[model samples]
Target: MSNDRREPATDADERTMLEGWLDYHRQTLAHKCAGLTDAQLRTASVAPSTLSLMGLVRHMAEVERSWFRRVLVGEDAPPIYYSDADPDGEFRLTEADTWAEAYATWQAEIDTARRHAADLALDDPSTGRHRRTGEVFSLRWILTHMIEEYARHNGHADLLRECLDGATGE
Candidate 1:
């Protein structure tokens, strides 16, 4: 697979191009999460931050579900990470017993997010309110947010993974 990260042109087909960028980032994050031991997956290498590979996988799962299902669709869906419970629950993975389980969760969330993005018309704006602050946002804004969030997190993952092992991005 090519390591180059330049997104496909947006002018060709805006929706496809946007989705491609999102999918590329999702894959990049997964690539960083792959090939690790249980201990390494759970290790908090970034001091004071409990951001492990497993935790990031869980967090991404919540992010995909919450954004694609709840926010974009405006469904009366329960928040994936927190629902008046604990805010930090997204990063907390008590049941990430095995690496396989964690990866499966991440993959399932990714599939759902992809389907949600595919089902939308690029011109149609999303109609969900932000969980906090009660602010409403459009699909374009959400997609851009997701792309930015993943890009930033993937950069962090690059350094974290490199420190965990000598591996760098392809």
Candidate 2:
């Protein structure tokens, strides 16, 4: 049988459950990205939009920092790679940007996300409010949202990796 990216367990609590799913999704993205050359990863054969695996890596790192550090922690967390002038900059790559660096940043951001998340209970509310709705989100909402974000992007990573080297898997 194929190895499950997500951890399997029946008796896990809420936080553990969310963490497991999120980690699984994160690892899935990394697995899809394994062994790709920088140029191959930069290929946006998916077309008009530049959503390469490298872009996804950088984007997810930004997402984690924004949610966990900015929204949840209420710290002055800003975009790490992308900015107002070039929001899609993460996907815009050159020969210099290595997959190794992107993956390293992604893992570091994941660790930071976990570190920040562990200090709070699922029921705890955000230290900051939502920008659009002006509402404070519960930790439960953030966990679920993060999982959803990774789930969607990981699907894209699957397709991108497949196009890159004919490699595919769950």
Candidate 3:
């Protein structure tokens, strides 16, 4: 309940609302991981599940890079974690993985994403196509999808944090 996340404005314009909600969710994820030790950040939620706060941060970095840099801006950015050989590479933490690195990478990706989308119209089509459908997406669609993605993962983060400690909030 000690979160610093800003609630999205209910009376804002469409673009404002979307960006605000996305940022709110982003801050929510950060809040969930704050004040945790390295071990706590890397600790898996439960047996047979490798989902951890650190992993989520890494995974989100890859996601932000993929959607914004690779798709939206047509950059040749590659995945930072997962690949064909290991699709869940981000989630499979190694001894070398550190919260500092993961958080930095995630923050960098967020910054890049904001920069790439800053002046683009929401209706503008992405330069890249979906890997499966070969269909191009609009910035609006991508933004909405990102909001959904973060919302889902933030729920998992909520559970993870609760398990790690006793913290819970909206």
Candidate 4:
């Protein structure tokens, strides 16, 4: 007989449920990026399009870190991908770096974001005033925003990865 050891789902398992969904999405992004070389991951398929597997990874890293650490936690510092002079620097790859470095950088950002989220209650308020609009929101809103941001980018990553080398799926 085949073995199945999955835990039974319970109605009270809200935390586990949220985490499972979050993990599934994160894994999908990672799977889309699997088995890609540095050049393949970094290459731009069409002119004037900044979308690439590596660029998406970097972009998501910036998103996660910016929302969870900088905005939610109210860090008095610049965002990882934001520069006053060049706002598009996150999508622009100006250097030829190793694949390992790219993946490691992404992983590091993901880890930090996860740790920060785990430590905070979702209802926790943002520490600083928003620059764009004068509004206040809880960390819960930030996390949900991150999920939506990732979902959109992951879809783009799916197409970009397929175009890079015919790879497909989450």
**Candidate topping TM-score:** 3
**Could you give candidate 3's per-residue lDDT for residues 1-170 as a string of tens digits?**
46777877789999999999999999999999999998999999998999999999999999999899888877888789999999999999877899999999999999999999999999999998766677788999999999999999999999999999999987
The numbered model that scores best in lDDT is 3
lDDT of 4 by residue, 1-170 (tens): 12122332566365565555565566677777777777887887688897777777777777766776677766664656558887877677855655577678778877876786787676778776566785666866776676677778789987887788776655
Off by over 4 Å in 4: 1-12
Candidate 2 residue-wise lDDT, 1-170, digit = tens: 14446574768987788888888888888888777778878888656888898889999998888788878888887777887899778888888988888888888888888888888989999998775677888889998999999999989988888787788778
The pairs that clash in candidate 2 are none
Evaluate residue 115 in candidate 2 and report its C-alpha lDDT on the 0 to 100 scale. Answer: 88
Question: How much lDDT does each candidate structure score?
Answer: 0.74, 0.84, 0.92, 0.70
Candidate ranking under lDDT, highest first, comes to 3, 2, 1, 4
lDDT for predicted candidate 2 compared with the true structure:
0.84
Compared with the true structure, the alpha-carbon lDDT of candidate 1 equals: 0.74
Alpha carbon RMSD to native, model 3 = 1.0
Query: What TM-score number comes out for model 2?
Result: 0.92
Each candidate's number of clashing pairs is 0, 0, 0, 0
TM-score of every model versus the real structure:
0.84, 0.92, 0.97, 0.83
